[model samples]
Target: MLRTLLKSVSELSTKIDKLIFLCQRSAMGVIDRRTEEMDSDAIHFPLRTHEELRSLEAALDNKKYRDHFVARLRNLMCDDTRKSAKACLQYILSPELANIYTLHGTRSKFGISKYKFYSTVQSALCSHFRSASCPEKEILHAMATASQAFLHDARNKVHKRGWRSKERLASQALSDVTNIINDTSTST
Candidate 1:
């Protein structure tokens, strides 16, 4: 019991530390696109697909990808002269889009809540990128599909079989109404 509490505290502390570092980098001018070179060694591999994400996750599981992704994200986030990081985050986190190159920092790494929904999304992205050459639209489609699936699963649990039967009955009734309207129109 004590161990779990300790682990939670440690994780929370680490997250806070990372957030602090991000803020510090933002304050410093290290993130300015104008002042920074695009081809700098401080950057890490871009994460645009699930495969890349998986690689990052693999690297993360081995404790190798954290520093690199964090540095890159921090640098990008710190870019005060441009909207690169903000735009990237917005696109990456968008439900309608998959910001493949930036969303999942590394493979095994989970976000704040360690939610499986996001992990499943990362895996789907990895699979999509691995199978296709041009994946921009594909990734977005996958995200939308995955999101719907996740939401459906969550909603399904709350919905009883009785409710589904009721829904079917309601649909049949609506269809009958439509049929009657069509018959009336045809006769007129």
Candidate 2:
């Protein structure tokens, strides 16, 4: 029990240290585009099968975060002036998200999935990058449900094309699920 607590504390301390270094880089961006190249010695992740990567690629290619938000994140990360959204998008599409290129310094590795990486890093990054924004909490949950329902029913109302933002569509999906549940219960 004590060992687990010690490990957790160690991890937290490492993350805090990384966050400080990232902040230092963020300051430089204000003066220049932060084009300073990050070290190329970043650890690489193992490759997955083509089919596995293709599916993940499709999802990441479909990522719809507001453009300004994405730009700010890239700026704070490293190589702000050099890295492109398409490149970042490609990077995240792979299964190596947790193990891929890390914050500019420190060898700490992340253990979250591609879908979860942003959530874990957001608050810290947001504090430094004022333009950073994520979808609302409820919207994030709804999107998770929608992704699951898409697996169950591609033709479900949640999959219908609409002008709504991704977050709105996700929120609507939750409402749709609730309505269906109520209808079935009342009918029974």
Give the number of the best model, judged by lDDT.
Answer: 1
What is the TM-score of each predicted model, taking all chains together? 0.24, 0.21
Per-residue lDDT of candidate 2, residues 24-58 (tens digit): 54442321235533321221212223333323322
Local distance difference test, each candidate: 0.43, 0.39
Clashing pairs in 2: none
Q: So what's the TM-score on candidate 1?
A: 0.24
Model 2, 133: alpha-carbon shift in Å? 43
Largest TM-score belongs to which candidate? 1
Show where candidate 1 strays beyond 4 Å: 1-45, 79-188
**lDDT by residue for model 1 over 1-188, one digit each (tens)?**
99999999999999999998656544432244454322223223333345433333333442233444344444443222123323334333432123112223346432312433244334434443434563556555554454444333433433533334445679989999999999999999
Stretches of candidate 2 off by over 4 Å are: 1-35, 38-162
The total of clashing pairs for model 2 equals 0
